[model samples]
Target: MAISDFFCPQTTSIVAKRERRKEARPGELLNAALDLFVEKGFAATRVEEVAARAGVSKGTLFLYFPSKEELFKAVVRENISGRFKAWNDEFEAFEGNTCEMLCYCMNSWWERVGATKTSGITKLMMSEAKNFPELAAFYQHEVVLPGQSLIRRILQRGMDRGEFRPLDLDYAVYSVVAPMIFLMLSRHAVGACVPAHVELDPKKYIATQLSTILYGLRLSPGDMEPSQEIPQA
Candidate 1:
């Protein structure tokens, strides 16, 4: 019998099912690998363990990711890229005055950080980066630089519009963003050693910090009454 005539509908259906199973294999393996990497440090986590987590044989995991390093990089990239896109979208939607825009951006970023477990992962990566240059480079190139650049552009626009005081754009960007970064790093990465100096409310912290940078905390013109003249003693 010819090949077409010999193949029954049941045989064709079985082949189609096998093909779908094969196609789904890689994604399943990647997800399993990511979960393991996040739960266990990348250097300590073994490929065999990842395969076991995915319910695939060791050889099958290699077919999807050639090396453990590649798999770890993929996990970080996949986790953070969606977040960057969301931030960009929120920034683009900002239509308020410059002060309002600054406040909005800070609030949006804080909300995002609170929403994702990625912050914990980020803390892990930073602590481990000294040992893994490749992963560190990937994060710097893919995440940090792009975010800073976007912020710098916003600051530049605000400066041009006279909504913000004229200052070095890079310096301005750093001034606004550095505190938030430090707060996370100090609390999560380094571990706070000091006793509670202030309440740890993220919203209030962000508002107070941003206001200090954007508008000095010193009493505004209307808030202070003119001082009565006094002769020097």
Candidate 2:
């Protein structure tokens, strides 16, 4: 409820638009926070700097986010939560074969979460989890569990259809995610000074990992034959 909205009925529409813009400031601030958090680890990012990047006063930032951890949680929610919901929504209506669904889901996952700078958050969590247990727990409940559940559902679907062998769902989920997790860690833990020959490339790594995963999951001879190569990652 902005002051302008209370003052006049005649200009109510204009005031409503102004209020909406004011409401949008928090999201803009969160986006700024995300960029800074990615560039500098969470512990190093200052609230004043986030406020400056967001074009708002430090007071305004506090009005929206009471603490730095709260702001970080907001950034995490913005980057992962909404996308997860949308991913599940799209997945619910997906009509592909189980194997195709696996590839489709991974490709979507990589594009939506992996390709973006936001993906760095996963590595951040891994590094900070011991020191920031509550934050790690929040992420576990909010993002990781939901994501693993989605994979579990897909694996169950394959088993039900006899497209895949019975699998230990927990281990299978780790198998699916390990490569992407490794890549995220490698980007941070493996410094930029590494030789070109030793540097890891995500496209190839993801491709090889997926191919191997599908190979083991396939129940039929033709199922193992890839319809298409992973496009020369």
Candidate 3:
């Protein structure tokens, strides 16, 4: 056998290429796991299936994630954690009129998540939190709280500037996001459960909801705009 053919066989290049791709394998595995978990859920998704989808063997999968639960945790950490960090960082740097900012943020929120695959996470959490308490807790601490905090900061800023009414910050925060949360759940959970509770065009619904919310939250009209004088004797 020629030395070149003996030492550097065809399979050798493929093996070397795969070895060079080791750094990306974990991310690939996590992405595959996310898709499967989103589709079949955590309880139903198998490690072997995730491995197959990721183009890795089960043994290789275990080398990175010892168990399915650990893999799921990695999925959460990789996806939600990074997204939340970037979102919070952007929110922190935002500067504008509170009403405009509120609308902008709400619209951005819906586009980024409410109508996307990420919305399924709300369903997953609700369904699986009882069984996966540790993962649920981590998700709450890392994702939910940060999200709530961002909402609270926006609402608090509006209130602080006399743009919105002074309201209970805690519950107000939740109320502000309640519609989006409900949409997320309803879309993923009971999207086609026979008779619908309410059919809506999301854009119109958001406009109406935000209008109502803004009306309620804004400073009283008398305080906002000067009252016209009554000239009648």
Candidate 4:
């Protein structure tokens, strides 16, 4: 009998079980390594300890990740790239005003990062970038560039629709994005003690930032006005 025609329930079940195990194994190793790295700092965490935490042999960990550096890269890819992919998927079907859509996407992206356990890990990666050129390059290429591209596309659409003024697209895109990056990084310096009254709410903060940019770029005088009726005092 042909191999394709010989499909049996027992064989299929064994193949499915093996596939699940293979997928789970790498994820378990990565999570264990990430936890140790976050807890002990990357330089202090050893591979053997990661293997022990993952309940796998050191050889098996090495089989999946050839080196410590490679494993760290995997951790970054898992935490950072995966988040961006989720954001991209969430907004893939988005159709709205260019400025509003950009703000929505940016706000959602920040919210997701804020919710993740790996936010501290991302902070570590940013702080250690000077010492880790490969990681820095990977982060810029994979995360920053894609984000910039999205921003640029939004600005291009606005400019095309004459919704925004004819400014240098590159500069306008950067202006919109750079402030958000600064605000996100500012959290590390500001600490959790930001007073409740003054604490930066991500959604409102993003809306204000995007509004400021739109104010500068918006083409129509009426577009600058609030879109709601004010109650008569």
RMSD of 4: 8.0
Global lDDT of model 2: 0.84
Candidate 2: clashing pairs of residues = none
Clashing pairs in 4: none
lDDT of 3 by residue, 102-175 (tens): 88878888898788776777778888899989889988987888888888888998988888877788798877
Candidate 4 runs further than 4 Å off: 1-22, 36-41, 82-92, 186-198, 221-233
Candidate 3, residue 48: the lDDT equals 94
- Ranked by TM-score from best down, the candidates are 3, 2, 4, 1
lDDT string, candidate 1, 85-121, tens digits: 7777767887777678777777776676633455555
Clashing pairs in 1: none
- Estimate candidate 1's RMSD in Å: 6.3
Model 4, poorest ten-residue lDDT window?
Answer: 188-197
Worst 10 residues of 3 by lDDT: 221-230
Model 2 residue 197 distance off true place after TM-score fit, in angstroms: 4.9
Candidate 4 residue 124 C-alpha distance from true site, Å: 2.3
